[model samples]
Structure formats: C-alpha cells, structure tokens
Target: MKRQVIVYKMEGSIVRRVIPSDNSCLFNAVGYVMDHDKYKAAELRQVIAATVASDPTKYSEAFLGKSNEEYCSWILNPEKWGGAIELSILADYYGREIAAYDIQTTRCDLYGQEKKYRERVMLIYDGLHYDALAMSPADGAPEEFDQTIFAVNPDRTIGAYESLALNLVKDQQRKRSYTDTANFTLRCGVCQIGVIGQKEAAEHAQATGHVNFQEYK
Candidate 1:
C-alpha cells in the first residue's frame, strides 16, 4: 500500500489564500483619505505613484500600464473621445480582469442615421483588442443595424461608481432652437427595460440587466 500526502496551500500568478480573518485597515485608510479636503485627484495620483514606487516588483509598468493620456484627454474633451476620460481610466484599470470577473463595461457609439447609417464604433474589453458583438437594436426587428459600443474599464482595486465624480454627470444637450439640458438615464443589460425604437437594445437589456443609453439630436 502507498501513502499519499495532501497539500493545503497553493500559489499562483495573482494572490494566495490563507483563510484568515478580514482586516479593515486598508478600508479605513481609503475612507480617511477621501474624507480629507487635501485629497484631490492630483493628490490621489501622487499617492498612487508612491504606492507603485515603494513596490516596484508588485506594481511594474507591465502590470499597471495604461494610456493615461488618452483617458485624461477624454475627460477634458469628451467630444473628441466620444466618451468621458474618467470612463476610459476606469476601463484601463479594470479591463484586464474582465475574463475572470465576467463583468466589463459595454460601451456603444452610434453613427449616421437610418438603417444603412448605423455603425459600431467600438466593442471591446478595456485592456484587450479583441472585440465581441452584441445583438443590434434591430436584431429581432424588421431590420438589422449596427452601433458603436465602447466600455469604460473600471479600476481593479476600486470598481466603477466608487468615485464620486462618476455621479456628477452633466446632462447637457445642444439644440439649435432651444438651450435646454437633459440628463440621461443609466440602465443595466440584465434589466427588463425596453427601448422605444431599438429592439436590439431592449433585448440586450433583458439579457444583461444593465444598459447605457445616449440619444443624439
């Protein structure tokens, strides 16, 4: 007869598990910093820099690499980027973990009009170049049309909506006749919501529970 030895511990590319009690020290620190007036966006950047500098091996360029410039540009100039810089930053931070988490932003940009004018500008996970397709708004309808969808990568340590800035959405729509601004309603793909003119979007919402909507004038 042969005796077998059992292993209790395992290590991998990311984190190792020890089955220990949870600690709230890091959480406290995050809250404390956020509560302070000195903790501006620039200050957060400094803190991030310090954290990365102190642990080069853990936070190498290859590990935390992202197009911060592009993201920032979007924040300052959304018209050019189509989406906000904050969204891109979030995507840059969280995009890589999509496969593991099974949760990534589903962004879309619509161009042109009528059926033939519709186009899909983007449909991708944040850190990856591969694109996935969702059924168009016209999927089950009489016509099949395409639309652009670009997801905002969330921060790995801090998921989307954690930042207060995300809540500060300026609902502004330009009109040639009137100067009225309107805020958009955010929905998830997993919800049972329906769109008036787009069946694909409604079907997508039913399947995903959350969906993003932006009407152009």
Candidate 2:
C-alpha cells in the first residue's frame, strides 16, 4: 500500500511531521505508552474494517470499512492488489532456511461479512542508517515472483518474512499430524492376517484383482 505523508517544501532546516492513519503502527505503539488504550485499538480496528469494505481509491487515508474477505482474497489473487505479499510464497522465500517465523491471524466484520485475515510481522534490516516498521495483509507483492509470493517494501518499512516463517511452521505441523494418521491406517491394513509386508500386499492385491496401491510401499 502506498502511504503518503505531506511535508513542507523547504530548502534547509529540518522539520517534518508524519500523518497517521487508523492502520498505522503508531496506532498500536500508543498501546505501549498508555497500556490502557484498548479502546483506541478497538476503534481503529473497526474503522479499518470499514475502510477495507469500502475499497478506498487512495490508500493514504485511513483504510476503513474494508472486508477481510477482500483483504484475504486480494492477497491470494495477484490481479486485484495493494502491494502486500502473500503468506505461502513469503514462507517459501524466507522461511526456507531458518524455519522460524512470526505470523498472526485476525478476524473482523466488514460490510456485514466476517473475514479471516492473515498478517506477517518481522524485523527487516539493511546495512544503513534508518529502519522501518510495517503491516500488510497481502496485496503489495512484486512482479518477478508474483504468484503466491508476498511483496517486500523497498525501504523495508514492513516485515513479511517473519509472518511467512510462522505460516510455514504451522503448515508443517498440520502435515506431520496428517501423515501420522495415514501411516497408522496403512499399517493396520497391510498387517491384516497373511499380509506380511508391502511386497506381499502388492502381490496379493494383484493376484486377487484388487486395486494395487502404488503409494503403499
């Protein structure tokens, strides 16, 4: 998403102010300062939800009334976008090596639609002077690795890598559980009576005109 901030066009001395949005990180940061500002977070969440439902033509202002469905779908689908990266490709890109991540999922009602959205939070760095903080629910993916790949802001204002890594961990956990069940079921079936091993099972299945399982062995 293209965030905009207005600054005075002066030549020398330095003084710049940043414009805040409902979805701005400062919105969350204020929580650290106050600790009792849950109301603000709640209010911003609602406004952001609404803006998301409205589908603002310009992303500079507070994104209000936007549906989580739109946000989730937008991230998955590359055509209708806002420049944020997707979780799948993000995990594959950065989580491949470390296997560590920090991703979160939240749900909100937008335009009467309950939407489940995913966001990635991470630390981004460069061998330079300034640093940035960011939040994106997909939409801003790059062109080269577009399909399912999340986009990284050029200035590293946001972190998508951590979220990607978190997603990968969850996926792996689910897959392992599923594989365990499948293996147990196969073992039970193959060890029945005279079925001694994979080869025996295959031979019995073939001789008896049963479906010879290619994946069983």
Candidate 3:
C-alpha cells in the first residue's frame, strides 16, 4: 500500500496505513507493524486463542469477563473484535510495547509498557478502527519501505517518535477523524432499524439477533 505521508518534525514522514475495515482490523494492524503483513489476522487470532487457553489462571473468567473456554472460542470467531486483552497478549508474545493512540481522546494506551520492552510499535485508534503508524523515508514513499518498529530507551523514554505519533493523532482529532461510538447513529443492516450509539446497537443485536450495522452521518 502506498499512502500519502504526513510530514512530522522528525526526519521522515509518519503515516497511518489504513487497514481493511473487516472485523479483523485490529489484528491486521498489529500484524502490519510486526511483520508488514496484514493477512496474518487469522493466524494472530489463533495465537490469541491458544495463548488464552494455555493459561486459565492468568486469563480467568473474572479477568476476561467470560469463562476461559467461552472467551477462547469467541476470540477465534472472525466477527469478534480484538481489544485490550488481545493487545496485551500479543505484546507479550512479540516482546514489544504496543502504543495505541486514540484520536477521540488523544490518549496513548501502552501495552506491555511495564515489561520494559526495548522496541515499540504504534497504532492509531479512531474509536471504531485501527491503523498502523509507520515512518516513511519521504512524503510519498511506499509502505513496504516504511519503518514500523521503533526503539525505546532503557529509561522508558521514546524521545521524539512518541511525540510525532501523538501530534499526528492530535491533527486527526482536529479534523474530527474519529468515530464517536457512544453518540454515533447507526442503522441495522439486517432490519434497517435506526439505532443510536454502540450500546443501543448491541442491545438491538441481542434482542433481535441483528448484528450488521452501518454508521450514518
């Protein structure tokens, strides 16, 4: 993928590579940063399922918000979305910190930060989607030549790279790039019933088994 890059104050341009809008966007975004392959979503899902299954105590029902068996099965489902738990597990598995910058709140959630990982990768979360952040050599460089993994100092400081990411996220926020899931209007694709917010969408799905929804402006 060749995306137009955003020039940061640093040497190269930092760009957000848009991941597919499929349900596996989070996994694909992580995979893109880890190995430059977006198609590893299925493999990553399997890894998450296996990792959770291997340790019931660490990933207990109280922690996972569901039974271990059920959570494992649910994570393996293609429609299910990956979140904080999956990010932490994958961060441990890869031995790198995953910094997820939210455009909605301009908050950076660092997974595996406590482990003191030497390397870190960035992901942009727009409330409803995840995109990989990479540093390209130039403004129009190809994504294959971009650098996704960055080094963190032993003292836990990332220097200018982290600032670059946060600035980019702030720019996106200024542009209203994030979806406000709590207030966004959605229409069920199954029955065409209008819904407000993710809570209502989930409730409608549970009550009437309508899972497909599209956001409307």
Candidate 4:
C-alpha cells in the first residue's frame, strides 16, 4: 500500500523507526541499541534487574526510591517501568555510553560513557513519550558499523557517526536524498493494506473510505 516515508537529517544521513508502545519502551529501546531484537527486550529487562540487584551500592535505595528488596521486586514485574536510571545501569552493563535525545527539551542525556563503544545507540524522547532509535544510512545499512557523536549544542544536538561508519551511507544513497524522494509506503489504518505509491495511496484513501493511515516501511 502507498505510505509516506520518514527521513532523518544527520551528518551521515540516517533513518529511524518507532517501536512498540509499552511500559518497557526504554528497556526495549536499550535492547534495540544492542542489536534491534525484540526477544532481547525481555533479556534486557532481566539484565537491568540483575545489575541493580548485584550492585546495590551503585543503585541504592535513594536512587531506586524504595528498599533494595522492594526495588528488586519491582524490577521483576513487567508492569513496572524503567527510564534514564535504567538506561544508566544498562549503559554500564554494555560498557558503552548512551545518549538520550529529548526532542522537547532539545537535549541529549548521557549514560555510562567510557571512551567509545563499538556501537552507539540512542533513545528518543518526544516530550511525554519514548521511542527506540533505529538508525542506519538513509540509503542502506551496512552489515556492521560503529559511531561517535559530536553534538552541535546542548540543545538540538544529536548523536554523531564516526568516519568509519560512513560506509553505511553508500548502501542506500537513493532512498532519501530529499524529502520528496518518496521512499515510503502508505497502509490503510483500518484494513492495513498497502496501495503502492503516494498518489495511489491518497486515491485509495478516497476510494476505500479509510481515513487513518500509517507510513509503511
């Protein structure tokens, strides 16, 4: 089906994705940072729980807002959620620094950064909500890569890629050179069928009498 495409502007052009809406979005986002796997999401949750359990000195009651036992109990519960604090724990666990980009405040939050990591992943905060960061070259993704971000400013600054990671840029160069490149599909929100192209997607909307739409990958 026809759908609108999304593009991100970066020094080395990259693409991003939205993730499942759940209490563990931050944790799942961290899991995505490692390898973009959903099965890893639950594993990440358990890792965070265990990390805190083993290092009470680092994640004390003050930081946890409850007794160590209570906090560990809460961590085991899926209904309970995590945030930058969890992100911090995860940053150290991964032995890499993580930056959280808050679009509302236009700032990036740092956690567990030591020199540089083989991979860099970021968590996106849209004011009141959180989403996972799924970035690759706008044109195409590489089999593997690494990154380091030099921020433009305290606000509006985003993650950056190392020169070596520029290899990903060559893979999908035509996918998104401009907003009008139109490398997206439109799916009917009601029926979830793709229409083909932008114009056709629009016509499908009118013909099928479907009002809601989501950008198809």
Query: Of the candidates shown, which would achieve the greatest lDDT relative to the real structure?
Result: 3
How well does candidate 4 score on lDDT at residue 53?
Answer: 84
Task: Summarize candidate 1's per-residue lDDT along 7-90 as a digit string, tens digits.
Answer: 654211111111111121221212222232212333334344444455656544465444444333322321221122222222
TM-score of each: 0.20, 0.18, 0.93, 0.57
lDDT for 39 (candidate 1): 21
Global CA lDDT computed for model 3: 0.92
Scored by CA lDDT, what does every candidate get?
A: 0.28, 0.29, 0.92, 0.58
Regions of model 1 farther than 4 Å from truth: 1-33, 36-39, 66-217
lDDT of 3 at 55: 96
Residue-by-residue lDDT tens digits, candidate 3, 1-217: 8999997556786799999998899999999999999888999999999999999999999999999999999898888889999999999999999999999999999999988999999999998899999988789888889899999986786878887888899999999999999999999998999999989998998899777788997
Superposition TM-score, candidate 3 onto the true structure: 0.93
Return the TM-score for candidate 1, rounded to 2 decimals: 0.20
Query: Residue 112 of model 1: what lDDT?
Result: 23
Candidate 2 deviation (Cα RMSD): 20.5
